[model samples]
Target: MADLVAELAAAARNHTALARRVLSDLEAGCRSAPECELRDLIATSRTVPPARWNQLLPGARGIYPDACWPEARLVVEVDSRAFHGFGDAPERTERRRARYASMGWTVLPVALRRIRTEPEQVLAEIEAAYRAVLSRRD
Candidate 1:
């Protein structure tokens, strides 16, 4: 038991170190993305694995959104069908959307296929959603 506890503690420390490195890299990369209206409008930010949402929220269905812009009240989720599979995907997504709605969050699910095939359309949708969220805030 003591050995297992020590191993778990070591793993946790390693994970934290890795997370810091990844976050630093992400911040550096973000500096290169084009500066735009959306970038200026962000309020709060967080990055966590989707499963962590359960810990973030107690009773209600907690969903770990891929990316969230809290100031814009937007939650962006990237869905890679290849990895996530396609069985009843839309239905499950809709349910998750409803859950977010119930929590007063605007959820946007960006499919990997669309991102690869029609990036412009995805950008347009994202911009439109941002605008809509902004409008609601006002």
Candidate 2:
């Protein structure tokens, strides 16, 4: 998908900047607007380490987290209301988090609304977790 966008950007005569920006976000593994916003926050944060979006974790039986610092074993899940609903959705999310936790990964779930309203606090928490994970390794 990113390669296709890059090709389009290369051939496009106009709006190449927009295409390039989209390509950059896609390459960074952003699947939604909220994820992109979180990525931007992490990118600009002083304390939080960079995250790899949607990467498969071998420790979690091939589960791909929303934003993960593989070396730190930390994951930040961007919870959007659009997808989460009544019934089994919440249960599934919890079970997923449990799987990551069982694998010794620190999982942080952040709502889409909070990402827009309290980005600073969110980043701070992520940074704190990142630091704690690294410290444990040391």
Candidate 3:
């Protein structure tokens, strides 16, 4: 059983790496018009996960976000339908979002379909969320 579990873990890790690579490739090819404010930010950013927030909230499990744009006061979560709403994922996501909100961070949940079908729109929403955070900060 232990060996089986280990193998499953390895497979999960491999799959995650592949997904990240695909996202990176897609992001790299993203083009923005001159009027878009988030082009630079989105283009330069790599995937930002929750481990980056460990200093802010220690000893938190399953609390990692897809991306954490600290300067922008944003926490981006990529919600794939299969992984979401299964078991306790919904509750877990809510708990994490609340925790981040308590720390004055704006949470942005982006669906996988949106990432694939309307990346530009997703980027726009992220920019708007960041802008809202800035406005609140001021």
Candidate 1 structure, TM-score to reference: 0.51
As for candidate 2, its clashing pairs are none
Candidate 1: clashing pairs of residues: none
What is the descending TM-score order?
A: 2, 3, 1
TM-scores of the candidates are 0.51, 0.86, 0.56
Which lDDT tens digits does candidate 2 get at residues 24-90?
7888888888898899889988776678888787555668888998889888988887755567888
lDDT by residue for model 1 (1-138), tens: 455445545675644765544343344232212211122222221221111211233234456555565667677666666424578876777787788788788777766666567666666777778778888889
Give Cα-based local distance difference scores for all models: 0.54, 0.84, 0.57
Q: How far does residue 97 in candidate 2 sit from its true spot (Å)?
A: 0.8
Ranking by lDDT: 2, 3, 1
1-66 per-residue lDDT for model 3 (tens digits):
455445555675745765444444434332222112223336543442222322233334455555
Identify the superior model by lDDT, candidate 1 or candidate 2: 2
lDDT of 3 at 68: 58
RMSD of each: 9.5, 2.1, 10.4
